[model samples]
Target: MSLRTRLTLLFTAIVSILLALFCGLLYGVAEQYRLREFHARLQAEATTAGHLLLGQERISLNLYKLMDRNQLTVLPDEELIIYNAQNRLVYESGTDYLALTPETLTRIRNEGKVVWREATREIVGILFTDQQRPYIIVASAVDTYGVRTVASLAQLLGIGWCVMTGLMLIAGRFFAGRMLKPISQINQRIDTITATSLSSRLPEGSQGDELTQLARRFNRMLNRLEEAFKLQRSFVSHASHELRTPLTAITGQLEVSLLAEDEPDELRATLRSVLDDVRGLNRMTNGLLELAKASMDASAVPMGPVQLDALLTQIQAKIQQLQPDYTIHLRIDPPDTHASDWQLTGSEALLRTAFFNLLDNGGKFSPDHTVWMQLIRQGTELQVTIHNTGVPIAPDQLPTIFSPFLRGRNANGHTGHGLGLALTERIIQLHQGQIRVDSSAEAGTTFTVSLPG
Candidate 1:
């Protein structure tokens, strides 16, 4: 059933149960009150009959006449009988009177008081003296109109209960709808959002309830999805551009070598150029593959504690072999001491590739300039900052510099596939770390990496 109908039914049931209990209690109390009132009226009539006989000094015929005159108005269902001490019937009232049984009469006479029975209806028999030699035994059936009165009151109360229960149900439905309206609206808005249109949001009402908070949370989720889509688009575009450059170069060099057939020297030179292009293509292809692997691996791979100073020293030695003209400076704060006790907790080969990429970029961009590498520890975090005295990157360009296939404006036709920083970023993120660039036109650029201890 719908929520409104269910709530209404529940309210009706609760009210009905309460009303039934209240009516039952009231019926019991009203029945008792009616019985007490009936008894009081009967006792008053019996007392009056007793007084009339005591004053007359004989079996007064006037007592029966007096009772008959008052019977219809005062006690309609009552019967009067008088018997002498000898147990003989003396005076009687009402035409249909059935005399008390011999056993009942004997009991009343011996007891010398009033007695009652409730067999077919109600019967009461009383005995009294008449100021003469004989006594009186007056037997009467008690009034029973009180039973009808109780039934009528119960019927009236039952009607009132039904009316109150209906009102309660109506009130319950109204409040239930009012309280649930926000949730209903939220559901409708959610229904509007599908795979085709994820931008739709729940309408915010004037009430600052939980529904508003829920809408805000859903909007945040949509925002994250949009960011992921943008990232994916950038990755595809950059990958295509990076791959096409090497393939085009390889194809052009091979075509030129194929066309030159007469001169051996020219042919050998052209074939060597083709060979260089092939090697460059091979290197770019391998870098792209590494970038793709880094992006795809969601699980944190196992890692051993890497000595940062030793790694840097080894990288510097390698760079020196490749480019003997450039000066490389490695500055380690508290030199020879480990900055962090925590392991890198990822693939060491990938980490080395990331660091090598950064170093290569710095060296390739600044041929004759100094490259500075610094490692420092600050409050449970380790930072590695690499500074290169190359051409400065613009503030607008710095943001996209880490994107794949993105090259600085100052690259000046230099050769690069540009997946270097992008791979670095993905690897850092996998380790729960962050990388950022700080640059100035005069001060060159610094790439800082921070990792938690």
Candidate 2:
């Protein structure tokens, strides 16, 4: 069954069991009340018959007839039998439906009063004493009318149970639908959303129930997916333009040379121009590859612990090999610390690529070809700062410079694809680290990387 049907059925079943018990209890109480009232009427009739038998001067047949017709009349269908102290039948009244036996008489004498049932009839036996003479009065009557009344009540109760159960089932289904209406609306809205229509959202109710929380979480997930799609589209568009420019240059240069039949010197210069375009193309392609790798998992990149001070020394040595005349000053704050505390968990190659990009940017931008590299420990985190005495980046351009192919206005004459800082950010994010940049006229530009030690 559907969830709505199941919920309705469950509620109906619970109410059904409770109503059944209530009906049984009501019937029992009603039956007990009717039986008690019947016994009381019998006792009253016995008292009246005892007075009639003893008040006479002589026990005659007319006296018996007078008592039978007038004295013993009480409730409908009532039968009366009177026995003397010797246990002999003295007078009888009403119908002789029940006969008194010796055993029955003995019990009534001992108990004074007794009540019992025979088939469909109720019997009450009472002992009456007047002037020390004892008499036994046995009375019986069929509660036919009372029985019919109880049966009618039972039939009414059965009908009421069925009617109420059906009503409860209908009410349960209606309320369950009202409660889950939001979920149906959400499902419909979600069905209409596709990759191109991620802007659509589920409607949320004001109530802070589970459904509200679910809508909020789904909206958050949609926001993330939309952002990722936009970023991917931007990267692909920029990459296409960047790749096309170099290929166009190389193709044009080769076409002109082929048409000129080429003087050796002119052909050599055309080849040189084409060679330069090919090298730039190679560099841009390699930068794009590095950017892709930075976004990958640590397992794909082969991770290990990298020591900070040692890594910095190695970068300095490598930069010296490329630019022997360049100089960078290195500093460490409060140097007394454990060696293990300086270690970071990550891919050595990826970390080295990120550091190289920062250093290259620092040197390329610095007027004096000099930069400052600082290593510092703060609690359980290690920080590396590269401060270059370069022209400060414009405040507005600082935000977008880390985006792919987006160079600062100050980078007008720079010879590099703008993928460096963006790649560095992706690598740091992959390792659960943070990178931030501060730039000003007084401070020049500073790039700080913070990683867990």
Candidate 3:
């Protein structure tokens, strides 16, 4: 069932149980009070009649006169009896009277008090002494007065319960609907927000409640989704452009080879060019695949403790071999004995790839300038900073420099697939590290990588 219906049912059931318990308690107390009142009145009447008989009053004549004056008649279903001092029946008052059972008589004689039973309806029997003589008086009726009082009370209580139950049900429904209205609105808004309309947001409510918080959180989620979608679109577009360029070059070279007539030298040169283009294409595709895989499954590629100084030394040696013309400087701080090996947790291959990419970018952009590589330990973190005197990047483009296939305007017409920094950033992120660029028009650019040591 819906939440509102369940809430209503729950409320109704709780109220019903409480009301039933209350009514039961009230009935019990009221029944006790009524019985006490009836007993007290019977005792008073018995005492008054006994006093008059002991004062030499005509007790039988007085009772008969009272009955006549009050127009009281002995009902066929009622009983009236009187006994004298000798325990002999002195007067009888009803047509269908049944004699008291021996057990009842014995009880009355021993108790010397009034007694009654359900079988006798409203009958009350009293024992009295007149001049040291014992007598019994019995009276019976339908108990119309008690019956009317109990019936009225029950009727009033029943009506009050009905009215209260109806009011509670109505109030319950209203409150449930009011409380759930925000959720319903949020659901509707969410339903209307498709991929095409991801920019849309739920209308904020006036109350600063949990529903409002939920809407805000949902909007933030949508914002992230929109950003991811945009990145995916850019990646696809850049991939297409990068792939088509090399394929076109290879196709052109192949066409020339097919059209040429026995010029082996020219054909060989064209085929070599084609092979170079194929190799470049292959490298770009592999880089893109690595980046995509790392983005999707970083957890699958577990990281272990990697020595930072050793890794950097290795990268510097490799860079020297690859680009002998460029000067590369390595600055490593003295290892601290207290330090835990200056090691970080990461996939060795990916970390090496990121290092190589940074070195290559430095070498490619600053062929005439010295590149500075620094490794320093600060607290529990390792910092790797690469500074190169390359062309200045615009402030606006700085934020997106590490994005996939994004090349700065000052790349100097260099041939690159632009996945280098993107892959570097991905690898750093996988290691729970951060990479940032600080650049100036005259000071060149510095890329700093911070990793947990």
**TM-score of each candidate structure, all chains considered together:** 0.63, 0.73, 0.75
Q: Which ten residues in a row have the lowest lDDT in candidate 3?
A: 68-77
| lDDT, candidate 3, 228-284, per-residue tens | 988998999989999999999899878867876857788788888899999999999
lDDT of 1 at 296: 71
Full-model lDDT for every candidate: 0.73, 0.85, 0.79
For model 2, where is the 10-residue window of minimal lDDT? 67-76
Model 3: what TM-score? Answer: 0.75
Model 3 CA deviation exceeding 4 Å by range? 32-151, 326-328, 331-334, 339-341, 377-380
Q: Give the winner by lDDT.
A: 2
Sort the candidates on lDDT, descending order.
2, 3, 1
Q: Give the winner by lDDT: 1 or 2.
A: 2
- Which candidate leads in TM-score? 3
Q: Which stretches of candidate 1 lie over 4 Å from their true place?
A: 1-202, 252-267, 296-300, 303-309, 321-326, 336-346, 367-369
| Model 2: per-residue Cα lDDT over 81-167, one tens digit each | 888989988777747788778999999999989999989889888888878888898877787778888889889999999998889
Better of 2 and 3 by TM-score: 3
